[model samples]
Target chain A: MGIPVTIENPKPEAEAGLNDLVALVADGMARVNTTILSRTGSEVAMIPEVANHLIASGGKRLRPILTLACAQLCGYADAEGRDGDVKLAASVEFMHTATLLHDDVVDESDMRRGRVAARIKWGNEASVLVGDFLLGQAFRMMVEVGSLRALDILSAAATVIAEGEVMQLTNAKNLETDEAAYLAVIRGKTAELFAAACEVGPVLAGRGEAEQAAARAYGMGLGIAFQLIDDVLDYGGTSAELGKNVGDDFREGKITLPIVLAHRRGTAEERAFWQRTLQRGEIEDGDLETALAILRRHGALEETMARAEGYGAEARAALDAFPDGPVKAALLGAVEFCVARAH
Target chain B: MGIPVTIENPKPEAEAGLNDLVALVADGMARVNTTILSRTGSEVAMIPEVANHLIASGGKRLRPILTLACAQLCGYADAEGRDGDVKLAASVEFMHTATLLHDDVVDESDMRRGRVAARIKWGNEASVLVGDFLLGQAFRMMVEVGSLRALDILSAAATVIAEGEVMQLTNAKNLETDEAAYLAVIRGKTAELFAAACEVGPVLAGRGEAEQAAARAYGMGLGIAFQLIDDVLDYGGTSAELGKNVGDDFREGKITLPIVLAHRRGTAEERAFWQRTLQRGEIEDGDLETALAILRRHGALEETMARAEGYGAEARAALDAFPDGPVKAALLGAVEFCVARAH
Candidate 1:
């Protein structure tokens, strides 16, 4: 008679891994925060205005934290190669922020970080142009750091991210997007930055190629897990936690993992329902509830969470290259924290 | 009764300077063209579809040509530092093309390069993302050249260009925007890249700081002249030549040099006419003609061309460091060609 309420869904817990990583990298983070605020400042008022609207918004700054933590894990202390780490960390954050501004416009979402979106605040033209400004500043910082290897990694990541965005656009609202296709989208959009952020840390620390590879693998797995959980949470999380309205991905017809699983498991009639709501954009009032019912009936949410947990494990295994230490422990905990959000 | 056609505005002539530059750099230009096409070919179908829609549409490729000519003018022959020149030249062209894609989206243009605009053909989201791809590739090529100074200059130009775009946004449709403000906008939006494009060539050629400074000055002056001529042509040139709809600036409320002069010199009635049409968007069928008449009455077009020619002279003066040869003559002639577009 109503939408199925799955018992597999658990209450959202405090993100301990994120908190630990934040505290562990507090000093490096302070430097990064300063770099971000300073770089966003421009003689052109609109550049800073639109940039800070989102940058100043209180996201976890997790991507930069990953950069700092990964660098520390690789034994890059403040005296040795810490300056490069901090600079690269800030660069990663700027790149992330720039993508968010552009992504909001592309997705036509009106909210970001629980506030009115930059596109809504300054208009799409301002958002797009300011995003370019941030990206330009990101590259400037990368050049200042003067690490060709780091530059190569981050610049390639930028290209991959853009390509991923185009790939996502091509797959949007398509009922036929499969798990392989879904993984490809997240790998580009989310995981590549995560991988680049972690990989660059070891490269700057003068660590061996093996350490860099481990860092890249760890970050990529963590990024995939994090995004999978995000896709999961879009259906059920609170706006306070999400910083945007729930059901956003659904509203936008993003072909995320749960939808892919649900579509595969549902009946022919259920498939038609999804086709009408997602592909054709005939989202009725109770369509979200019905979609949830079908997803739960087929255990799609639990399966999606299980897949995220698998990725989180892979991420932890990648960190095993480092000897046991606070930094390593914190990174593993961070992986757990990413998957825990789905609970 | 009709729009005043100024006697100073002669019929469009053959672009001798451009033709000469192209011929002088023909070998390097061939390599650059190859790099551009190779880098732009993406696995994702939409990216190339949107990118090549603009890139292959017969742009003058003036920026890349400048990079080649500047390097050759500094005595960087193919046997010496020619490979880097070709890559960087391609990089400059890619950067220019990226900006064009974003510019069309920002301006909501429906035409570019005498064809339907990329935004119209693929939508804003596709255009913006593809532009990012080109920029990412541009940096990749810059990094491969292994010149930190070149990367620094180009990256800084990218940031300044974005700021200029925002400045232009602030000045749009505002009759109060003066000559100084207009110059600042163009300096950021246009001249910065021009300056960087020329400066990087000398920098890569192992040239001294003095030579680099000279190249920067040459590029800055040429870029200013080029942009001023573009502004003039926007009001009077054919769509075939301008590669955009004429009177676009007027319709969009852009305060270019011609409008700045006319606004400074116009009477109360004429000022009100500008305010009503440009500031308030109350354009009538014959308003473009009326606007042209006002421009002619103040000799704004002719005076704008004079300012462009002045900058062209400055550009030629900056080339004094280079020895007399085919490259030097071609660069000087290129300046003449840019200004000659007005005639």
Candidate 2:
């Protein structure tokens, strides 16, 4: 389905585990990073520059944090044998960083998260190549974990991620793109990594195939929900609320779900607004208001939120296979908050 | 020391070990290809379109060839450990294919080995992500080999190659590039995989540090020489000789050693031509002829060949440290051809 089905929101009390996951993500970032940065390059001149820029660029570190929470919930609660956990998290981060560098190059974008992108600051060539450097380094980190299963999971996720990126490229500026195709693209581009992160945790904990698969499913649903929310925020939230410029995607000729739904369900006049603003790449001041109005008139925004909520519900369902525990609760909370977060 | 001093040319002859190495590479390709294709993607619809284009446009498979050669000369001459040798060869091929995909994207070139470039066929997004897919697949293949040292070698080489590519991006059309800087670039961009290829052989063969290092030294020197001869071929040979246009580098404004030395050692009148054609990127019809003449007149071409000879000599010296064997002689012959091949 292009749009996700609607699901009831979970209890607010579920937020407890989500907060813990966030803090766990922060700790994982500091711990895995020291080793990762040191392993980057032995050469003195370029190593620090590369590491500093990479470290300074703050991210949610969502994948690593998920990994920690999954491992904890699966009953590997202590830091003992956490090397594999840390390394997998680092691997996810490396993949994330690499994609960022390459994404900026492909988009020819200069700015990301309020900082000049690596492609712009260091030059496109460096950004592209350094992205590659980190990808290889990530593999090196994972190999020491000594699990073929882990390698297979991460590698397959990577393939999906790249394929997702291509799917996005193909889908760009095409108003006819339905919600099904859009979700497929996101599955590859974003959800795959999340799935890999959570899956790797149970895998490292030496769980059975069923549990590993369950964790993986949980991650996949959560990652999709997270990205869906991100897309929704691009339209619904303000700059201060979402910490990004609103209406930026429509301006860049990108076709998010809100546009997809509104274009299909709106009146002829509403459809024309999308065609002019998106297909023609013309976004004037006050166009955001017009676009938001069309979305509201067609009930597309609510529909989009419903889709994300469905994924969040599916993500929570994946955790039902695991036993009752704080970690499981935390992971479940993460899914709810991921879709519900305005920012 | 910017340009390597010419080492004495030895009339190298073929050995059986080298022939076996060739067989090993060819066989490795045949065997691992099933996994490579399947791993790239499972969609039957997309397979013939995305993966086939690059795979069919075959270069010499030189990277893997280097790995087989490394294994043999490093004393893995016994056919007993064929899988290890083949896996390494396949791993190197994976890395090379990945780079080729990425390079085509960054350069935005249309022609590769007289066929439409992969990016041109699949589009930039497919090209980029497929490249990422191949890189991820490469790590998977390396994991299959089950050696941490092999993983380290390939991973380190991958990073260096990326860094080298970035360095080249930085140096594009900048005539200020010197011989040492040029050498460093080549080492990263071209020589790294070669060095790793050769080193892995000894490591796989269960050799000690000295032998592995010797194989590595040989591979690195031979790769540099191979690149030097390629640059020379770009200037002195025809399209048929080099597999594509002879002067494609000049057209794309790449300042290789031929131009690097000409820029440094040419007359004032000649300097203007270098500045305009290579540095200024205002190359025209007559510039190719004029640039060729300047290379000849200043003896830059001869000197460039002399550098190739020097690297070739070092490549041979690495072999002398090895005990007498058929594989050793074959490795020697390959290095000789690397520097002396007509193309």
Candidate 3:
């Protein structure tokens, strides 16, 4: 009933190591999944019914997978390590789900992942309530993790993400956007989770503080790279893969990185087009095409790619502290995959 | 500028004890308050400005006081005893504040304690973001409490509180709001915090399981009683003293204790009124008075008061485990105050 993140694209050939790592995650995820999804166990009709609808919408569990992968890669023992690795992984996913639920409500987005959003299906009240339910579920999962350090990281990440959202709102349609600001927003909103997901693994693994920091950094960098690519894909990705109406950002008057770069390099004529349109928070026909042309002319799309590459490199560097193993290698590939994925 | 709870009621009497606690909480809250009341320290400019208005609102530290009082009554030591008490108490306030910030957003409330609500001031996006910030700050503060048990209790409470919010939203206005069902919601939303406050005290005091559970029970029962009183006051209390808009709950289409009781006992004619006004999800002119009269006629208001009294008695029973001392007496007074307060 809610906006579930659907992946319509055919599964890419996950690198061999990544595939194996995901198989391990799938097991843990199934175990944690039951508890995370049960928002209302009450006999009350409205609650359990509406709750069931929201939970029934499947999610990709990207954040959880990153957590499980990072923990396994960092050599947190599946056999001997703490239970937190799985719970924390679930916690991250819960946090992610809560945010998405709230995001749909805030954006007033009617559909997500090719289905009517929860807000639309159940009403804004249900959407907001379910969002709160997911949040509570996240904290419940965190309590099971029993690591204050992990709680601190995840909670802090949530705060930062919220701030990022606010920042995004205030920046809507103001065309003087730049790379630095865009990156900052991305890091706060998107990267913080990516960072938290990866970082929590090290902490849960009982890895030393240094390794934990390293993992955190890796997640942070990868998250930024991932978000940047997402911004680009919003402009370029097909409807089937993106599960979004193309040019949603432009239509919503969001000033993303490509637009920021193009705006930076605009000629007087191009500048006039945006100043009269985008900066004023208005859109005209073919505005999306014109914006794409500006990005191409300024080589802004390529610059955006270059920035993603930079973050990917940084993410890789952050993982250097991990022990050399298949899991580590898999984590490395995942970062690459994070940036390189088509959708 | 947003409505401020701070301006609504400044606790001059509790200020000394609370200040000692505030001195401890001020730094973390200041940071969280800044981040919460402000934007993400990124590109967007309006978030922080909006946040500032909401954070400055007046609110009493009743929850924290209960936490500190519980600890003091249990003869808790900071490791350093009193100093520890202050920190722990402040942690309670921080958590409560964090929840408040988040609650306003979830509820889409436009006012708090006679001030413009945070969401209205900052928009839903910033309010939500700041609320997240406050939650994170709360965990950070708890971490400073330095006990795994403290983290566990607080985390569980956080989850329950969120769940309570969900329950409240789900349970809104259908008129099936039975006493048992209503208690569950109140426990999740209100009692959990009160219970956490008391339990955290004993944990800090290095008390045994029996004492901790007893203290937690005391807080939980008190919270329920307190909420019952709140519902009662909503119908009867003057807006001048309560600092809340009268009939706002009805306007929000909520089905609380009085209405539930009235629905059960009212005449067929009254049932028609209830169905049309409450279940119909709209309160028309003079409906508040009519509803109040129905409640009185059916003894619904008195029944609610009696239920609150029963919980208050139960709250006192939970404290029987504690010693006979001034701290214990204060804790008792606080419980009484929770239900007995005019505003």
Candidate 4:
């Protein structure tokens, strides 16, 4: 086996959890998808072309779904004038897609969601401008919702995500990058948006601070779990399973959790190998396979999943304040779904 | 003369108008500058590095000054709890700077404000991410002000700006792009922000809709005039005067007003020259000089300035309802200053 298969019987956790989550938020998701399509429509043909290219590419619409589910869990209803959650959820997706477009450009990525990257398809200039258009559209939707609190959450998250990107850039190819630094980067890049997406749901519902905090914590935990699983899958999962090429993070010299773990646990010779391959970006033909072997030898993938499980547990715990309703159950299942990518 | 020197003795219009306007809103401008500096500060080293590289690169701060001056013209005072204009003005600068950074990247520019472009200094990735950071900060500041109307104005402007950018992309190097299409491009790319900047001031001061509309009109007119002058300067002005390389627009094959005018009036051979150099992008040595000779032959520069003057007069007319005062005079003078660039 290219990767050590620790789970003798891997459960279909992602399939089941995602299906249940989608069912729980089906109506809201439908409205959100419609809102996304309508808002992304522009007189400028290039705007729609670039935006739709990314939006239409199949990826789980998890962040927006979380927004809707959290709103439902908070008991928000249209009667209470909280129907703006639908738009806000769509805004969350736009923000996510915008970041992805910019991220692909930053990463100089070749593929996304099993297809050529937008940057590769249209060029870097188009990717950057289209990303800006999406962000502008996102802010417009947030303004339409007329919630200063929600706007605050989402805008601040946008800043955090940008900062996270910069942080990731600084840490890339630096084998000396530590776990705390890794956590901070992921928090800014991945968890912050998730936190904002879920937190705004409560803000839209006019829920109390505790409820908002709980929702935010749930999202942050799930997001961290999701990213951790992503890091592991980069080394071990198939493109069919992950919807992206395996070893991409390696090629990009991204210092994810497994890399950090493997580096910390490695011998002096192994450290030199990482330094040359990752830090110097001088990868040879078999470096990726060797990296995978090193990761398995150090139990890095296993430990990374264990860490993801911990975050998943934390994510579930954050939903304790809400009653054990369908929304909460779906949300808890999302945490399971995200972490189960490692399986 | 390449363009008609309508002003026999050219006044320092931009310099004088900017000085008077700054004096009128000196306190607000200072505060706005402070807010800009503070908001752009981040723990991420690359963000500040890339952002400051551009923010300090000697932009005239014209957009923020307009924001402050317009707020003052609307009688917004800190005593009346309209101090948020200072923040909003800074936010406007942030938005403008953010766009400039992205624009340089999109345009593949090597120089900005007589210095190397941020993209050259850092990278396209840094410039794009830092630009996003500034925009996120802009939205956060808007949210802090808690004015949905102001947010609405600015957010809509942002979308329009993005659309304008895409429109420009589609129109780039196309010889057939007409004056109407050119006007539409400038309206989206340049004037929308100016209109939004001025309109938000009135919104903050709780002015009537007519007053807001007037302010927007003034800004729109001045902005179009400003951009018209910029297009003229690209061909005739020195690098020292414009803070960018002359012929940049021509080199990039940007179909500006002058180009449209020249194309419409050109002989068949001249039209063929434009098609080969612009539409087909086979730019030969000394093609810029030939293009200049053609613009002069058609009086495109003079006619472009005439159009700008008309808009300047319209801008002054938009302020007709307001009482004569230092602010109003400075505002009117700004129109002269903007259009005077053609002289």
Note the B-chain TM-score for every model. Answer: 0.96, 0.88, 0.84, 0.96
Regions more than 4 Å wrong, model 3: A1-26, A32-59, A80-82, A275-277, B1-52, B80-84
For candidate 4, give the lDDT of residue A195. 93
Q: Write one digit per residue (lDDT tens) for candidate 2, span B204-235.
A: 88888998889889989988998887788777
TM-score of each: 0.97, 0.87, 0.87, 0.96
Best by the DockQ measure: 1
Give a tens-digit lDDT track for model 4, residues B1-343: 2333222323565568667887888887888877888888999988878888888877778888888888888888667564698889988999999999999888999999889999898888888899999999999999999899999899889889988988898899898899999999999999999999999888888899999999999999999999999998888777766678778898888999999999999999999999998888888887888888898889999999999999889899999978899999999878878888668
Q: Candidate order by lDDT, highest to lowest?
A: 1, 4, 2, 3
lDDT of each residue in A1-343, candidate 4, tens digit only:
2444343222676779878989988998888888899989998888888898889986889899988889889978878554598989999999999999999888899888887899998888888888998999999899888889999999999999999999998998998899999999999999999999999988877899999999999999999998998888888777765668778898888999999999999999999989988888899988888888899899999999999999999999999988987888888878878887668
In model 1, residue pairs whose N, Cα or C atoms come closer than 3 Å (at least 3 residues apart or on different chains), thus clashing, are: A114-A243
Considering the two chains of model 4, state its CAPRI-style docking category.
high
Worst-scoring 10-residue span by lDDT in model 1 chain A:
A1-10
Query: Each prediction's Cα lDDT score?
Result: 0.88, 0.75, 0.71, 0.87
DockQ of each: 0.84, 0.45, 0.43, 0.80
List the candidate 4 regions with Cα displacement exceeding 4 Å: A1-11, A80-82, B1-10, B80-82
> TM-score, chain A, per candidate?
0.96, 0.89, 0.89, 0.96
Per-residue C-alpha lDDT of model 3 across residues B180-205, encoded as one tens digit per residue: 77888888888899899889878887
TM-score of chain A of 3: 0.89
Q: Write the per-residue lDDT of candidate 1 for residues B242-295, one digit (tens) a residue.
A: 677678888988999999999899999999999999899999999999898899
Steric clashes per prediction: 1, 7, 18, 0
